[model samples]
Target chain A: MLIKRPDDIKPSDITDEKIYHQRRAFLQAGSRAALAVAAGAVVPGLMFPGEAAAQVAALQFKKNARFSTDEEINSLKDITRYNNFYEFGTDKKDPAKYAHTLKTDPWNVRVEGEVEKPADYQLEDLIRESQLEERIYRMRCVEAWSMVIPWVGIPLSALIKRFKPTSKARYVEFTTLYDPAQMPGQKRGVLNWPYVEGLRMDEAMHPLTLLAVGLYGKVLPNQNGAPMRLVVPWKYGFKNIKSIVKIRFTETMPNTTWNLSGPQEYGFYANVNPEVDHPRWSQSRERRIGEFFKRKTKMFNGYEEQVASLYSGMDLRHSY
Target chain B: MMMYRMKPALIKPLVFIACLFPLVFGIWAGFTDQLGANPIEEITHRTGDWALRLLLITLAVTPLRRMLGWGWLLRVRRMLGLFAFFYACLHLLTYFVLDQFFDWDEILKDIIKRPYITIGFSAFVLLVPLAVTSTNAMMRRLGKRWGQLHQLVYVVAVFGILHYLWLVKADYLLPLIHAAILLALLLVRAWYQRQALSTRRTAPQTS
Candidate 1:
């Protein structure tokens, strides 16, 4: 009986694809359970195991989409656990611990202001019409940290086009859910209550922008902004608002949360430009969430070729 | 008085090991992978926090001695100050080695440019001389100058708090707490100095 080390085993001896995938799925579920335990949440093991499996099975999205990046997708645990959703709290782990109270089901998004169809639409109905695509994007935070995430969503353009923006709509404003009972952090005046973010009309209509519904092939965990969120890869993560409840199109530039909080620190155009440093810290380098060494932050977070044209003549230093 | 009743040899070693506990815990946390999701930031923050905390603890020794009449507290003051320096060194090393990876040009630029980094780096630079001259022989050699040289700790503490305040984007609760503690400590020292001054004047008139 010879014991073969992992390195000594040849590719020919590898497990079958079906078995491998099944094993991977089991590991993923086990890790999620471990994460729940780590966060001091009651383990869902008492519930039917089949029910959890069925939920995972039902979450189907097209794979290897054209928009997906080649970068390694961050672990599902990291994506779910490490978050900056201030609605829950300021600490990174606060959201994972406190976001359980949020009720994402029966959610409705009200599209209003400069739109032809100004009415409340069910979140499910909005997602049902758009084709879901898996996009692996580099998400750079204004805090000088980065993560590569595989997001499942439809292009934001698809959702915005449905509302039919009038010619007067030159800017788009997004609002996060604002229930203090559910979101404990809202009790404190962290950022003038409900977090608001915005983008230029052309930027909102860009193909790269996504109205994310899920991540890592699962319905988003509450901490990761359940039901729906925004994903603007080229801009800072805050610009990609979370738990969005309303999207309004207007002729005037909307006042974003951070920009209002500290106008000197945060600007309207929160593009990921390394050359433009944040007032208190350098943006030239960013630590990839789990990695030890900091990497040079790429211009527009490496999507420069695609989105750089949007700000051809503008000074990023001033606008950042 | 209880601490004085104990032998200096035994108490000194105990204090030495106790002062090193934070660095040991930090190392243990790193090896055990318990530094959380962002290990670099966690390690950087932990070391920095310990450094500031120990510096404040070191500052509290004089007030504690005068208020509680525990002169033996002075014995641990040097050790506490050195431990503060030790953690400060670890904090700066983590930034240079792990965060910046010895990119001298970038590190230099950060020290020159970023206000938070500039103040933080200056605080570390000031600590280096105090740490170097911490030995009994140097204290003996410098005589009264040693006390004057070590007054720089107050300035270092100021920079440490400012560095923290500037770095955090929002939720300044932690830094504000540190600020309050520092303010109280400084006020206590000032109040004590005023008391000593008035006592000296009264004694001369009475004589």
Candidate 2:
């Protein structure tokens, strides 16, 4: 039951921060090399392809924008290919096949509820002001699977502050896009259409909470909740609602999709607690996407230091 | 008569080889990466599925013999039952080695806490006694007790169906289909039993 401190995590356990920053460079060079081979063309001028690629991949962020973790980031292919965005379908492969129909260019997120400056903002205009940072986080799903992802986004606190929430805003609710034509899974009621998720006001404002716009140095793929999504590292992946179209701050506890579907299995506070077993399956261990054997699931998904104080007095087993 | 004409040595080996088809195909699929993105899940599901299928097929042998008047069918009943046990072992091994990684404490908790695992574990446990007594020497040693003990297969089938029913999140179509097949097999046995009972009762009156 011993909890390892983030500092105690070995350097080798985490993907090097340099590798994460240079992911774009690696990808660009890889694709370029493939293209060059296909075209029977070689670099005429460039002597060091790696150096040139690094320069191309260097992205500028705010001075204070960086959240590094000691967990290895999952491959981009695995992240995009193996997703649980049930809006497209229930099967793992369904999203990649069906999410192509989604139109993300003309996207707008409507900000509403207990806020002074409640208004709709275009996806581009909204994110133009906030600084983007690359955060490596451990994403644990309720289905006993875990992944480490490098998310590129601004903190939710920055965006929430812009809206200027009233004192009555005790909680924040996020709503996903609900078009059946676009999201074919909506036709079948796998869950009540337009998946919803929420967080407490403190949790929402927590620096760890991210309003992700991109991942792995690219705009979020349609399968990975295109345009925008929430990334709450300490909680189950389902809490990170995708394709967010509406953001509402409320006083009451919001009805989340999974919690509504199976209250016993999923709770409002879906914190990644290994001790609190799901009614159907054991949560004590999780299979890291590419690994053969399961590793012990750390409480709060190894972010207990950052988020444990948020639920100081509440019993996680019951609340979960 | 055609089955009677065939030699036990020839047909038994053929049936044994045929029974191994599922395992062979499963291994081939695993090697070829045809088991898809989640290979472990695929193996677990396929092995469990084949185990249940073989158990049902074994249950069908007696009814087939009664309907078709093929006494020779009884010769392969033990083989079919053994194959069911074989697949069940593979199914259990997949869960233990691949899924659970020999985490006995977690597995024990699952067996005690989860209804699906409890039923599935019970089914596998019940099959063990029947499998142990499956040998010719043990069958002779046990005598009349052998038939009574092997009646556990009927209960095993029920647990197996319940196990499958509880495991699925939604889309009950596959489980319902399996349930329907099991029901048909059980109903046929009941009808035949009823016919035999009535005949026994009326035979003294007629005589």
Q: Quick one: best TM-score, which candidate? A: 1
- Report per-candidate TM-score of chain A alone: 0.83, 0.82
**Tens-digit lDDT track of model 1 for A93-147:** 8988888777776678999999899999877677852255567899999999999
Interface RMSD of each: 1.3, 2.0
Model 1 DockQ (Cα-based): 0.53
- Candidate 2 per-residue lDDT, tens place, B1-207, comes to 565476656777778899999899989988886775567877898899999999999999999999998777789999999999999999999999999889898889899999999999999999999999999999999999998898899999999999999987644667888899999999999999999999999999999
User: What TM-score would every model get versus the actual structure?
Assistant: 0.87, 0.78
- Candidate 1 wrongly placed segments (more than 4 Å): A1-58, B1-11
User: Each model's DockQ?
Assistant: 0.53, 0.33
Count the clashes in each prediction.
Answer: 0, 1
Model 2, residue B170: displacement in angstroms?
5.2
TM-score of 2: 0.78
Model 2, position A261, has a per-residue lDDT of 84
lDDT of 1: 0.80
Q: How much of the real interface does each model capture, measured as fnat?
A: 0.70, 0.33
Alpha-carbon runs more than 4 Å astray in model 2? A1-65, A101-105, A117-121, A128-130, B1-18, B33-38, B60-77, B135-145, B168-173, B199-207
